[model samples]
Target: MQEFEEFIQEKMNPTNIFIKICTFLLLCSTLAYGQAGYGATTDSVYGSSLAILSSPTTLPLSPAPAPSPDYEYVNLTGLLTVAGPFSTFLKYLETTKLIETLQAQANDTDEGITLFVPKNNAFSNLKKVSLSNLTSDQLKQLCLFHVLPHYYSLSDFKNISGSGPINTLAGGSYTLNFTDDSGTVHIGSGWTKTVVSSSVHDKDPVAIYEVNQVLLPEAIFGTDIPPPAPTPAPMVAPDIAPVADGPEVADGGKGKGKGKGVAANSSTPSSSYRITGRNAWMWAVIVPLFVGLIVVL
Candidate 1:
């Protein structure tokens, strides 16, 4: 019996040690959650700010910017302001129907986004083509050739010399050649262009570079916007008429000719839009850690 008791004690010793270590880790995690950094939660006890995990992380996010003001550009003010000199050139994005894709709130991702902007002169050449000659997919391809999968900023490539390939979101890549002349930056590869000025916004979130000359993929010219789709034809119901049981005059002697018909219109209900960007702090980090503790250690 004494040997059995000794064996039981030996087995329980390791269990006690593990519990203490887990307790320590739990305390540290709680402290980390209470931190007041970029993605931290803010309870009054922790003396931090509260926020919804979905919204962008801005420092001192007081008086949140007006939701999508009524300008020509609905949601791309952030992208426009950072791109500096390329500000006017991105107008083609609107004309080419590409702006709708980028400004859409649904496409937030970690892929590095690179935009190769064309100069105004490029558009002048495109205007010569008539719209009737273009296909829907061709216009989409022309605009897509400008976008790259990953984000590359002017500062990231300012010092590098020699030629390298930059891939585009359209499944094509363009070669890049960089030259620095006494502090001025020049970029040339397929098309002639120079970066007049550039700056970074919100840290690594945006890298805007302004350039002279146009960056064409040799595909945009001669292309035109596609025609709008034709409207669908309205549906017609089948005609059904009641048969005359007797002559126009009934056996009762009253003269009858036709019956009155009623027509009713059936319409579908419209859906309402909901307000997003609510500031509710989600406790996503703590829940996972607590669940794992009860499982494999």
Candidate 2:
């Protein structure tokens, strides 16, 4: 029983208990520090990856849209009726149902229409002559006479100038003449001679030129057309005569004057020598008289 008590005392010694406590505390501290360091490293790595993902990057933008084509369907009626005080011309076009044809031509991209728009004053000038006198077909043909089947800009008139008569939409004898005076464009329809007052529209597929007078076709009017005004005559410059050469008699007269001067000079020296001799004779006589007077005294 005494040996058992000694063994129990040795197993439960204070030094061994203290050493076990210290070893357990050191193991716990090492584990906690290792876990904290591992958690901090993991958080730092995750934050770095998140920052890289959240960062913005440049990307290409979409391209701009293309520009529209030059050829476009222009509203002829709206353009004329609104823009121009071409209300009279528009009424004629509408009455003759030619506006649809013009609009159709404007819609065509391949070919275009050249319209000669007469102003309100132009129609008013024709007030004395009633359009009611004409038939429906004649009115349509008259409206067609004002337009050409093809588009012609103000600059394009030069190409057709003096190139003979250009066929109009009326067909047959309904042709017109074009003459370009410098940059100005003049149009002749046999009955009327007018010029383009202004350009209303000059886009592709449509060209409208404002004219001073309404175009009157020879087909409607008789072929007994008036003659064109005569061009004014150019000013005549005065004639200028060339200068004549010097006369032979004048040259001879100058030579004779020179000879006379030489003769006069030759005669002057002889007269001067005679005058000197006389003066010397007088001096000799005076000297002798003076010497005798001195002796008498």
Q: What are the per-residue Cα lDDT tens digits for candidate 1 across 114-232?
A: 55564445455544253235566655565566555555555555546454655455554444456666666576544335564544332333333444445444354423534445899
Error of 1 at 141 (Å): 3.8
TM-score result, candidate 1: 0.36
TM-score of each: 0.36, 0.52
- Which pairs clash in model 2? none
Regions more than 4 Å wrong, model 2: 1-70, 127-129, 226-297
Task: Give a tens-digit lDDT track for model 2, residues 196-230.
Answer: 98999997778898998888887876788766669
State each model's CA lDDT, in order: 0.51, 0.83
Number of the top-ranking candidate, with lDDT as the measure = 2
C-alpha displacement of 32 in model 2, angstroms? 62
